[model samples]
Target: MQKLNLSQSLSQKLSPQQIQFIKLLQVPTAELDTRIEEELEINPALEEGKEEETEQSQDDDFEDSYDDDLGRDDHELNLDDYLDDEYSGYKMQGDGNYNSDDDDREIPISSQTSLHEQLITQLNFLKLDDRQKIIGQQLIGSIENDGYIRRDLEAIINDLAFSQNIETDIDELEEILRKIQTFDPAGIAARTLQECLIIQLERKEHPDDPVVKHALLIVQDCFEEFTKKHYSKIQKRLDLDEEGIKDAVNLITRLNPKPGGASDGLVRTQYIIPDFILTNNGGKLEVSLNSKNAPELRISRSYADMFDAYDKSDKKDKKLKDTVTFVKQKLDAAKWFIDAIKQRQNTLLRTMEAILNYQKEFFIDGDETNLRPMILKDIAERIDMDISTVSRVANSKSIQTEFGVYPLKYFFSEGIATDSGEDVSNREVKSVLQGMVDAEDKKRPLSDDKLVKMLNKLGYNIARRTVAKYREQLQIPVARLRKEL
Candidate 1:
């Protein structure tokens, strides 16, 4: 038998305290308030309330007594000693006053119905038998928010048989699904774009109208070519003129691609809480984190009181000893959390300051042209921190400027060297490309090669493939697809 070494080298990892700090740093301002509430709930020693006048007087007296013996050096105070010090230095001064009166305000919970829920609610009014109702409910549930049934029919049939204990054939199911598709929102349960349009056209009161009927035929038979904007082939097949093709294309364009998205009385607006706020004060750009999102968070005073009580109690008593140990553990945890939050704020401010300094011109003028090439390494080098740390700061953070709020990642772009031997942001090049495309004649669209030449003439020195990649990134199609009649 071979002799084996049993020992293994295990590297020390970050303590729970350090990990908590890193997590806090990653949380943006919008979610900071919720984290504070969570901390308050976990630590009973932590309480949220203003200190009474008598307590404040006692604190002042204690601080005065300590200051007389310790002299004027405040830096010697540790984390615990600092909290015991009169809450003077930490108090928000002048314009930094936080409104404590609205602490009791209740956040309302709205039971807003989703699109599918609304559709299901209407399904109840229809007169259908028990089995048909069950099938309709299943079909309604299958309809996605975009009004498409992307699920495979065979799988659905299997689900109904095994899960719901109901035997259903594809022919019968398809019939009911067609009826569900004809519900209030025209194309509710279509599996494809072609099916969606056909469902709507079939339900039309004037089904024989030349334009409507021709558009339905075009969608059913030549959908692949039609979507590619191959109007000449369609015109040749139908033997129609340019005006007739235009009428059919216009009719198809008017149909709602996402039928479920147009539900009335149900409006959903996304809330955008910015992490950083940038304003111009006397021609100087002033940057500050949105303090409203990050409420004033500190260790609960109740926890401090419990700690004090434990310290004063007799050490010989077993009950007191156990209580002291419990209180110490909780107090240590609370202290670690408070320190982590402070460190997070410091890191965030430092990282954002470096970013603002690097892109001062872009921030001053809300123009994409003013943006320069910047990467995580650039900011990390500027701030003398690790690239990974800088990346964490940028990942989820958002900045609000006079123009609009944008994620921190929006400012960074890879650089491309121009003919003048100067490096420019790829974002700037993309903007230039988009502008050129917007100005180009749709009847005779500019090809990728022509765009590359134009960009080179303008000193960008980009290859044809690079131009094509940029164009595709912007979702602009090829010249053939972009062509018009």
Candidate 2:
């Protein structure tokens, strides 16, 4: 049987304004202009530009009049809360305002043709029938950005039959593929890395050269051993001398691993617009938000005038009341949006300032080892904000320093204990590990165990697994794969 019971529970919920602030806070400087433009389009009451200076006494009088005119009647809506100036003390001196440096922030676009277009242009030069041209186009379409057509011939044959409804066989497709492979990039449309390298080598001017022949032979015959760097096995199997093999290896190493990377048309270049600009002035670090982040915004003056007109009108009909309600909503939305943008600017500055102070040593010297072990909680507590808020700021934001631009996430790292009982950033460990790898003998690369021992010798109390983890994170391959001739 069900019984009625009274239960009390407490819960916290974000108001509409607070939710709006959170969303605005996370938007990076790059996309902020677009977001603001969208708001301007939807809300007629909101506008873009500096808020003109008006008489404070007049604004106070307007607010007081609004409260008195719209009494506390159940039928009448109270708009006194929204009548006050939402932009008071909003403008920060020398911040979020127009300046001379605004011209430098514009990004120039490239008009170069893409990779696929160039390939298709070359395809036009081929003398083929309608069917052959279609197959050639199909093969070209299968080529990835790396310039390799990794799709299996059988699968492509099925795809053409099912999707294109064109009956084609493996032999006919392969013929067209070979013709396309003869394109300008030399290695374009190759099925495998070995084939890609061989295709490039075959196009060399001096095909009869001894080194070229050896390189082709090594790639075509002992590709697996060559990839594993088993130079001795390759020598024994090929019955070649050390100098001959080394020269051939050196020649193969110079070949382009990714032929498509050379083409300007296929790859879209991405430019990073940093959210903050940081500079080293004498010994002090200075950080400022990118000018684009600080847009000039204000409430439309005409919209404010509507409230004055509504206040003076003696007749309060149903239609007029509905119009006033609509005006109030638009005004409320405009005020909240402006307030959110202002709060976002303040929050971003606070979070970034705390980070700069916390990692002050690293920014000063541009040294990874100098970075301390910092987490979201550290910055959150310093700014009296939540950890999630700090994370939202760091996740999408970047700062341009005198040395270089870096994502805010780069400054945070876990701590590692040293023999001296001092806590150090794991970035320091990775830095040392990278140095060791770079200086290691090519013929005998250091294993994870060896790296762990070396690190421990330097007074770092780290385990073998942690060293392996760091090695992988650095994109360093295993000892076996790193072996070289």
Candidate 3:
């Protein structure tokens, strides 16, 4: 067991700049500003602006700016690499330094107050003693982003006693929670999805509306059955005929399952900034990366001047050289960052262009069926890059098309060969599966077995389990749950 063995194993490791380039490549348009700001804060030499020199003059100055030996030990460089146009350059845009027509600053903050803030505001109207108010505040705090207090009453009681030095029982906490539940957005302090739905239904209680009363009954008495969409069981249990049950079921379907999210289209949070934009001009497709992705960065002139002063100084004291070294190090870091950004832009453009060319038909017609079978390796081969490199670009990157915004992953689908000896995209199969479900008779919704037959008829030749997998991927519920009156 203690025997020594000599072995040689070759492993490739990414350099620091290469790693940086990969990270920067994957960052979406939304977070690019934050990343650039972080670099600016850390590297004094790096600043946000285009270089001031004219192209020809800058080329001439670049020669005399620094000799071969100058800054060689410091190592890193950028400006010349940027001008190299490394990765096949861009096609849709004039330069890889692409800019956006729309300003990100135009996006507005949420007009409606957040869920917890809204809950806290409602607590002001309640007439409570100090102890009661404190408990009420804790309960409100316990409420999650979805407006549900998922924590058990026992847990809250323990938390109050041990942490807040407030001796509170389960009963008192429940009273406060009940009061909080009565607040706006209808389902604020519910414990579960069932409870949230019941709260919304009870709030909309109407004496004359028979469907409303039946809906409440369905939620309270047959929650499990209602959730499974076992409409037949609910009808038999409640002794309701076809028409009556259908009306009641339809009303239940209309209830807000997620009351905390989009209450009558009055609340919203989060916005997605697309990384690229694709447009169809008659038949030709134009693709460009987001403007924020390509920032105009240049080394600070003042920092460069300081370095130059140090470089030419006759004072060769240890302290002077040390200061020069520090200046050179910072300058090198800034140059490295700038170079990484340029390479990131080049890689992104190359990757997007390859994907655009591969999925050209889909982008042109805005048709999912037109999307060919494409994978990371397929793109890697086309662009002559590593599969992992292509993957990094497609991972979080999104493109805005004339049709809509779509993630790069959306265009890359696995191949599924048909009985006719033709390979098609898995998306094509999913589309057929979705269409079948969408057009199925709700009274007797098609089961996975039935779906398999339909898909087989369409020349897919997929198994039932495969159909189930695709259905789950699409987030569509099973036959029993999908059943409707």
Model 1, 340-458: lDDT tens digits are 87678778888888999998988888899888999999999999998988888899898999989989988888888888899888989999999999999999999998998899898
**Which order, best to worst by TM-score?**
1, 3, 2
Q: State the lDDT of candidate 2 residue by residue for 334-411, as single tens digits.
A: 878988998999999999999999999998989888999999999999999999999999999999998899999999
Poorest stretch of ten by lDDT in candidate 3: 67-76
- Model 1 lowest lDDT segment of ten: 68-77
Top-lDDT candidate index: 2
TM-score result, candidate 1: 0.83
What is the clash tally of candidate 1? 3
Say which candidate scores most in TM-score.
1
lDDT of 2 at 227: 93
The list of candidate 3 runs beyond 4 A from truth reads: 1-12, 54-112, 205-208, 262-271, 279-283, 314-323
| Prediction 2 TM-score vs. true | 0.81
lDDT of each: 0.76, 0.84, 0.77
Candidate 1 local lDDT, residue 40: 67
lDDT value, residue 58 of candidate 1: 27
Better model by TM-score: candidate 1 vs candidate 3: 1
Candidate 3: what lDDT?
0.77
